[model samples]
Every structure is written in structure tokens, then in C-alpha cells.
Target: MESNSSNPYKDCLVNEERRLIDERTNVGTVEKKKIAIHMAQSNSDNHTKELDLGTKTPKPIQPILSAYPCTGLGKDRRCFQPQWYKSFTWIEYSITRNAIFCFPCRNFPTQPQKGYLFVIGYQKFRKVKEFLTAHGETNGHATNVILWNHFKQSLIEGTIKEKFVALTKSEIMPPGNAHYCSPPLQNQMLSAAGNIILKYIASEIREAGYFDVMADDTRDVSSYEQFCICVRYVDKTNTPKEFFISFEKVVDLNAESLTKTLISTLNNNSINAICVAQAYDGASVMKGHLSGVQEKYRKNHKMAIYAHCYAHKLNLVLISACKYLPQSRKTNIGENRASWRNFCQNHHSSENNDHIRSYKIPIDTLNIYL
Candidate 1:
């Protein structure tokens, strides 16, 4: 009931004897050369789903006299022999077409020129070896070789997901000194490696039984509040170590929010159970007994002892001393103070005034003992 006028398989004669060698199956003879090659590659790839071992060196296929008919005469009436097939790895002889083809060029042809043997049959037997050698030395052939090697090496390294390629000869040997990876690509690779290292460090810290957590929040130049967390613990050798683990953004700087963020980070690293102590700056929200971060944390973990930073206490004391101390005023203290006051009141001379002016302290500095 099908009309022959619109038949898709009209020109493709499907031979039942040998299906693989039919003209429809040959990628080189088909109008859809690209599609045929893609389909053939996909089918082959589906079968051999294993790591590419870059060592797929070609072993010359042995051709028999009956199977590969070479009795056809060339331009010079010379008959092709089995010795010609043994000479090259890329050369593939066709018995039906009486032609020779380049295997590598046919499979992975590069740009500009895909080589004459890739498109047309090479039937001239007089100088066949010369043409083969010339085709092997082209830029396209070298590029294809590099591509094949890179694909195989990537599969073996288990970095097929990363899609990292091996450095080419031009990149390795150079005045260039740099590889082909862009800045963004390099950052991505480094980020992956950094994540792996962080996981390892986290695991090591979790193995230690007890540790102390130190946290502080600061506003950066961009006005973003970032809270930094550090852990101090002893290793298997009993060596004390402190490690800065994480920096988290603080959307809300209240006791509840900061406690939640810190607890979340600890839980993520699997170290929430082993915390023995907590340290933070002497902010009212952190040190307040009723509704402080320390108090909130103790609701979950009671054994964690809270400690205010001594350096922060010292800074507050210094600020108080500077604020209360008078710079230019002198109070009466001992006999020295009375003596100095008597001398100043009695001797109202210009020389005494010059002497007092020489020792007078500036308003900016605090003279605590004066």
C-alpha cells in the first residue's frame, strides 16, 4: 500500500547477506555523512562503556587474498598485495569498491582539510606509501591524535565529569608557561579541591573528643556582618591545635539568630556533641545571663562553659580610663602639690609662666599621675 515515489529507502538497497557493509551503512558514501558517523559512534560507545585506556594503539589488520580482493588493476596495472596492508595502521582496504581509506581521518577528521583519502578512494598504487606518509604529517592528523589521547586520559583519571583535558605540546613546551584553562575554569577546579580538603579537616576535628568554640562577628568594608568560627582541640598525639573552620553571614545579629547560625554550622561539621567550652566578645547580647547567646546555647548544651575574652575587657577598661581622666587640671594631693601651688601663686613672674607653659600637657593626652 506504500507509494514508491515517497519511499525513504528507495536508493538504499538493504542486502540480507552482509548488513554492515551495505552502502547505507557506510558513512563515507552516505549523503548524511555527519549523522551516520554520530550514530555509529553512539552505538559503539553504548557497547564499550568503560574507562578509555589511552593506549589503544592500532595493530595492523591482516587481510586474506580471498576476503580482500586486490586483483583489480591500478593505473600502472600493478596489483595491491597483503604487504601494502601491513605497512600502515590507518589504511583500510575495501574489497567491494577496490579502494583504500584512512581510518583515523575517516573517524576523526579535523577542520580545513579532512585529507583526500577521507572523502575519495585512493586507487593509485604506484606511489601509495608516499601519499600515506604525507597525510600522516598534517596538522589535522596531529590534532586528532591529541584529542584521542585527551579523551582516554580523562576517562582513566575519573575526571570525566570535570571535563579536564591533558595539556597539549604547545602548552607544555613554551615561551607560554601557561596552560589553556581560563581564569573561571581554574577557580572552579580549585574550589572543588578546597571542598575536599575542608571535608578531610572536618573529619579529623570530629575524631577529637572535646573542643572549644570561639566566635566573633564584624562588619566588613562592604557593610556585611560576617561571623567567624574557630575550634580548638587536641589531636591523637595530644598536640593542641586551633583551626578556623567557617565564616557565615549574619542576617540578624540577635542572640537567637547568631546562636542558631553557630549551632547549624557546628551540626553541619558533626562537632556539636563534643563542644566543652564557648568563647565570645563581651557584647551585652552575648554575655547577658537571661537572654544571651551563651544562655541560649546552654539550653541545648549545659556542660559548655562560657568565657568572656580578656582582651575585650582590657579594651573597655582603657576606654573608661581615657574618658574620666582630666588632661589640663591638677588636684591637691601631698606636700608636693601644696608646694607647687604656693610657688605658682607667689611667683607670678613671666619666667615662672614660661616654665609652666613649657610643661603644660595637651588636652588630647591623659596625665594620670598629675
Candidate 2:
């Protein structure tokens, strides 16, 4: 390990630092250096960079007045102490500048809204509360606070993925490059996270010993035959719990294919234990005697009892009754009128019905004269 003091390239580094060009030095050179720094910090391949915690918290607030050593004048020529400076979480007193700075605001730079508490030091003690209030209410400061709080919560929850996303969005990407974090990419990340959580829950269900499955298939908006699987089990609290496990797209809707898909899902999740029960809607493909999903599954696990869901049975009954029942529908105009009157009598005021009936009654010459 060569000492930096004795290194041969030490002068080259010092000269390089002096030669560094900025707006005050030369044209186009400072911009290039900044771009280099940004690129080095950026995650071009969808990877999260390591979090710089020092940048998030910045200068820690302390209570010792002597350590900060304020020198500015106060009422009656006394050394000033910032009234709003109570060693609050967001407050930090700068010893070099002899002024107060917002810790969270300086830690995460955003567009300043008011007097230069964040950029320039805030020293006006008389208006300290007013200035502090204004700085705290700024859009940029509020946003930073929310992001910082969310990051802290994620750390507490032990959610590394969420913490990574929060840190990347807040710190890694350069300011004003919001489009770099595309919506589609975010959705994909969320979906991946959901799959991980779902698998863990499925594992929990498998460990619960006895569970039942409820399955159903429907055509999604994209015209794909999507199968949904859910498991019901008694949880640790002795309460019945039901959780959705999977939504899979199937190429075929036959009894055999459906049964195979179900079996494959269960096996993949290591849920091969004997099923306590199974429930599905009454379709020939699902509930048939010899070749249906229930039959096939039952053959493999005899303890897995199959039942045609009673809810589906009731729905089918209602549809059949509407289709075949004669009294449920109007056969003629007179019958329709009678049905309307019957409905009004049952659902509306009987007094109003009687008044309507009285008006309908045939009034002779006496009523006409009156």
C-alpha cells in the first residue's frame, strides 16, 4: 500500500483538481464532468445502487449551544439563539456559517420555495418560526419528507425490494428525469413482487396440513381462458381462512387439461398432500362423472372429496325457472296490466291502489251531473 503523500501521481491529481473547469473556469468542460459523475451514479440496467444514508440524513442536529457557538446579535446586543431551533429532527445549526439549515431539505435538494434556508443560511431569529414554517410547507421539502419516511418504514418492514425502489426513485436517478422510471417497468416489478409473496403464502397453506381448493375458469378481457385457484384452511387462530393462490392461462378447456394444470400447480407449490375437499361450478368439463376434473383429481387423491358448488346450482335453478315458468312472464296485454296492478298492490300504498280502483269503477249519470 503506497502512501497518497508519497505517491508519484499525487501532483498529477492535485494539478488535475486545479485544472478542473467549471462555469467560472471554462466552457463545456464542467458540463462534461457533471455528466460523467451522473452516469457513474446511474443504474442503466435496472439495478439499484447502494443507498447513501449520509445524503438522506445530512448534518445531525445537536443540543449543545457551545458546540454550535452562535455569534449573531440578538435583542440588547446579546449572542443570538434561534428560537425555532429545539434540536428538532429536521433542524441543523451550522457552526461555520453561524446559521440554521433544514436537515431534510439540504439532505435532499429540491426546488426551493421561499427565503434561502436550504441554499443560503437562515439567520433571521425574529422571523425564524415564519421562515421555518415556509420551508417546511414547500412542495419539494414535503415530497422529500414523504419519500424519506417511506424508506424508513420499508427498512422497518424488512422489505428490501421496496426499499430499493424507494431509494432508486428518490436518490439514484438524476433530478428532472422522471420519465426514466417508466410505468410499465414499475408494473412489471410489482407483479414480480406479488408472485413472490403469493408463493410464500401458498407455502404457508401447504404447511397447514388440511385445505380445500375452489377453482373457476373464465375468459379474460384479452380472450384468454384464465383459471383461478384459491385455498381454504383453518389458520393458527382457529379461524377459517381463504386465500387466492394463482391465476393461470390455459391453452385448452377440456376436463383432462384442466385437471393436469391444477395438479401441476399444486405439485409445483409442494402442496401434494391429500385435499380435504374441492369445489367448482357445475360444468360438464368440471363436474362430469367419469372424465371430469373432479373425477380425475379424486382418483389420484381419494380423500379429496368433490362437490358441485351449491351457489352455482342455485344460479342455474334461477335461470331455468325464468326460462320455463309461465306465471313469471306476461302472456298478453291484459295479463301484463294485471301483473302491474298486483305488483303495485304488494309494493305500494294500499290506500293509493284503492283510490285508483275507485276512479276505474264505472260512474253513471249521477257522477256526471255532480
Candidate 3:
């Protein structure tokens, strides 16, 4: 049984429902919000995105009244109604508890609710109409609504907020140059949409149970070393699928550093993937039997296999090629080899030998004549 003791919330309420839903669930708040909102259709990175379809929390999502359970004394039985949800926009239903609640009051009820009412839940559908209207008129509900509107305004208007009621009433976009169209708002929208997609993908991968990891590091034009992590798994149909999940900035190419960075990124995304295999080029830091990334990772997932793939190194070569292009040549990533001949020194020899030796060499980079 849940504790009858009520904990009053006194925080802002714009996007607060996400926190409430998560708190009601067992998972982390950020992760739960991502997966829940993931159901909303949003722009994909590969697509040529247009502004009109930008990410936005259009409205609050409540439960379907059709599924509401019924209860009451003889002949006066009642169930939640769709019209009530429509009339009281603040209405929310918890399928777990088999009851309806007020979205605002559930998190930040300012006044005491006798019999727990909407704060905990209000089940007497027979009296719901009378009680809901009266509750809405109370000072508690009005105060909570004020705070919610303020936070909502901050998100869309770059201020804490005070405008949900007004914004919902507006039909058209408030001109492109308006404060609502600011870059910070656009970036936040894009990030929110991206996190939603990432969390959804993470869920699918974890549900698949066993997976393989693929990773490689590269020096970006900004001189930052980034490790790109990918995962491959077979879905319920036994069909193989692969996804690029993250590109994390790392301190260096040390096996320990890479392992920590990779593990942290995976955990943050809530992807506790059971790695069955790991694929990477045969660099000592990646494939070394003593203490490489594969070995370190296997300490956590002992069953994982280390599979070397020559083609996996192609990703880094592509990054190297980008530096040679006319658009990028002007701003070069520093190199100290002096000349192409000196850069290729000691012999343009055997492929595997060069591969291992190149793995631990200086940071000046290779003889990329491309």
C-alpha cells in the first residue's frame, strides 16, 4: 500500500508533468521523459528539416476515458468521462492507481484536500463534476496554474513563464522575428527531439537483449578526440541492425579512458546493453589482451568477444580525408612531420606492422597525401 502521507511540491510546473510521470515510475526522470516524448513524431537528422515542424510540447496528454474503471454505491455507479478531461484541461489519469487526478494539484497542491481528493486521487465520478469545478475555483489551483504558465512562457519565450492560457488561444505563428523564434529556443527544441529519439532507440536495443559494440576514435578539426560508439543487434525477427548512438569527447585514446567514457555514455542513455561482441581495428589500445578496451569492457560483460575488423578503421580515414578538402585545408589540424617522405619513413612496409606501430605513435598524424 502507498503511504497516506502527502509530500507537497513547491517547484515550477512547466514540463513538470514529465517529472511527475517519471517520479511515479521507477526510472530516472530524464530518461523516462525521453522515452515518453519519443512517441511524438519529430525531425530526423538526415532529413532536410523545415521550421514549421519544429519540436514543441503541444499540450498535456491525459488517459483515455474509455478505459476508466467504474465504481459507486448501488444504482449511482460512475466512471470518468471524456467530457471531463476536455472540460478540465488540467485533468490526468493514472492507470496504475485506477483513479483520476489534477495535473497541477498532484505536484503542487497549495491547499489541503480532504479525503486526499485530487492531490492523491478523486474517484467518486458521481460527484466528480461538482468537486472538480469547485476545486478549480480554489486559490490552490489558481496559484499552481500561475506558476505553470510562468515556466511554460520561459521555455517558449526565454523568460520562467506566464502564458499557456494565452498561447493556447493563439492560432497562428507569432512572426518569425518574434522572441519565440529565438535560437536558444530552437536549439532546445532540437535537443529535446533528439533526446526523445535516442531514448527510444536505447529502449529497442536493450529489449533486443544481446548486442555487439563498435567504436573508433578520431581527432576533429577542433583538436578534440571524439570516440564514436555504435551498437549492432538482432531484433525479435533475428534480423541484424546497427545504430550510431553517441560521439563522446574523450581525454585520450587510452583503453581505460575510452572504456570509462563509453560506459558513462551508455549508462546516461539508459542502455544497459548486454554486449555479446565488440568490433574495432586491431590497435593495441583496442585489442590488447592484457588491458585494452575490449578487455576492460569484458570485465563488466565477461561473455563479449573481440572481433577485429579492418574496415572499421575506414571511418577515421574518412575523417582524415575531410581535412584535405579545399574547404577544410585552410584551417589545418597541426602536423609536424616536415614532409610527406619523412611522414612515411621507416618503410611504407607491411600493412599489419604499420597498423600496430601507427596505433601508439606521435599525435602529429600520418602521411595523408589525399
Off by over 4 Å in 1: 1-183, 314-370
lDDT of 3: 0.63
Candidate 2 regions exceeding 4 Å error are: 1-181, 321-370
**What pairs collide in candidate 3?**
149-162, 150-160, 150-161, 150-162, 154-159
Model 3, span 1-370: residue lDDT tens: 8784523421122133334444554566576556445312111111122222112233444656446666532334577787777789977755544456666665555666433344335544666788789878988789977766765766777541224235546655455445544679868866877899888878888889888888989889999998999888888788898888888988877999999998898889887878889898868999999999999999998989898763544345435644544454554344533442343453245653455364543223333321
Question: Local error of candidate 3 at 326, Å?
Answer: 22
RMSD of each: 27.0, 21.5, 26.5
lDDT of 2 by residue, 1-370 (tens): 9665532223332333234323233336666566435422321211122222235542446345643443222221223364455534577665544556666666655554333455434533544576677768878878877666665775677454445547677566444434434778668867787778767767767677788888999999899999998878876667888888788899999998999989888787666555889999978889887888999988877888888785565455434434544554545536577754454345335664464355443222112211
Model 1 poorest ten-residue lDDT run: 8-17
Candidate 1 residue-wise lDDT at 344: 34
Q: Which candidate tops TM-score? A: 2
Model 2 deviation from native, Cα RMSD in Å? 21.5
lDDT winner between candidates 1 and 3 = 3
lDDT per model vs. reference: 0.60, 0.61, 0.63
Each model's total of backbone clashes: 0, 0, 5
Relative to the true structure, candidate 1 reaches a TM of: 0.39
